[model samples]
Target: MTVALVTGATQGLGLALVEGLAQRLDPTDTVYLTGRDMNRVMTAVESMPGGGAEVRGELLDVADHQAAQRLAQQIRERHGGIDIVFGNAVMRVGPDDDPRVIADQYTEVNNFGTTRLLRAFAPLLRDNGRLLVVASSLGTLHHLAPVLHDRFTTPSSLDEIDEQIARWRDELKDRRTGAWPAFVNIPSKIGQVAAVRVLAAERREDDLHRGILIASVCPGMINTPTSALWWNVSTAPTPAQAAVALLDLALDPVKPEHHGELVRFGEVVPFS
Candidate 1:
């Protein structure tokens, strides 16, 4: 039986994917639908239709490296190996108005926390297992160039972004100026690209054990709680819609051929 583990599954895209996966997973497969909220996550799981895959809600804060590691061990103990893992939790780190603090917070979770998830569970991902990083079109730099130069920078490594953060902290002694925290938030394109690049780089070898496929997906500007403000102003896809795209990668029969590709909707969107 193939089991699945998803972090940040309480609501928005996470919950949407869990709901979709619940319907898609076989009856024997187990799924760890997780998020930071215990009650809310449990409620979302129970409320969703067809808990066929041993649906269970786990209160997980992936930002906590120890907790993420422990969770992986628990999954390993319970299922022996995982068939699929969606490392998809991300957040802006601090108060939006305060860019310096905001940059710090975004860098911590969106970048470091994501790596933590991969580090904890990469070993247990079964051979031929697929790993999907729910990245953002916002993270697609080349697409948002020329017009978005003022708002977004070219893609770079999380380490690069972190270095900038460190520099911003030193330069901006005053948190009131605002852009200090914002500068550390790596452009969305960088976040999406870096996730796949880092994942593949970390696990390039070991093809013999089982072919693990990693892809950075730009799910487009989906209408989630975080992007609700864009609801009326911009055309946004639903989480359910985005879930469909993600499911394609998660359940693909041929992974190695598609690994490390940046995909959007149903197409293989190219990137640096």
Candidate 2:
């Protein structure tokens, strides 16, 4: 069976991903629903209609290295290696609610949490298996390559800078958020594209060690508990809609042509 593991599977895009995957994957396939909150996890599983029995939620804070690492190890022991891994767990410190809390909190959940989850789940990924991280358009490297060049401690090249700009704008053209357009749709948007590029550079090799086809994905701006819903309320797709596209990218057994790339709706947009 093609087993899938998605961290932060309780609410918003993560919850949508779990539900969508359960529908797409075979009935007998194992789908693990994970989140930091047990109550949220349990509640999410219970709401899955007939599939609740097949859907099981585990308590996991992907940011907690030891705990998350242990969970990954347990998956290896119980289910061998994961066939599909979705690094969908994220921590957005602020959604403009309080800009002051944004820095530390954003770094903790969005940045540090991303690295930690990728590190923990790297070994759980199977050869030729696809892994997708639920990232934001703001995190695209194209946006930050120039602004953060010096701060990131990476030397910059003109080609790299031009590429970053072109790619960033191209990736942004699809919508405010690359894929979701609601939950994570940040005004001035967070640099999800940038984060994905960073992760691809640092974690691509890390993922390759496990034979995983990894790519970071922008789910667009999904309107969740942490977004500006009132300001922009047009044709907003649900988490379920976003999940469908994300699953398509994550399940494709293609080559590294798009590996370590940022994709949305089966299309690849340059980030690095």
TM-score of each: 0.80, 0.75
Off by over 4 Å in 1: 92-96, 141-189, 205-209, 230-235, 255-257
lDDT for model 2: 0.63
**Candidate 2 deviant stretches above 4 angstroms:** 51-53, 93-96, 145-147, 150-211, 229-231
Judge candidate 1 against the unseen true structure and give its global Cα lDDT, from 0 to 1: 0.67
The lDDT values for all models are 0.67, 0.63
lDDT tens digits by residue: candidate 2, 216-254: 777775656555433362456678877877877776566
| Model 1 RMSD, rounded to 1 decimal | 4.5
**Per-residue error (Å), model 2, residue 68:** 1.3
> Which one is best on lDDT?
1
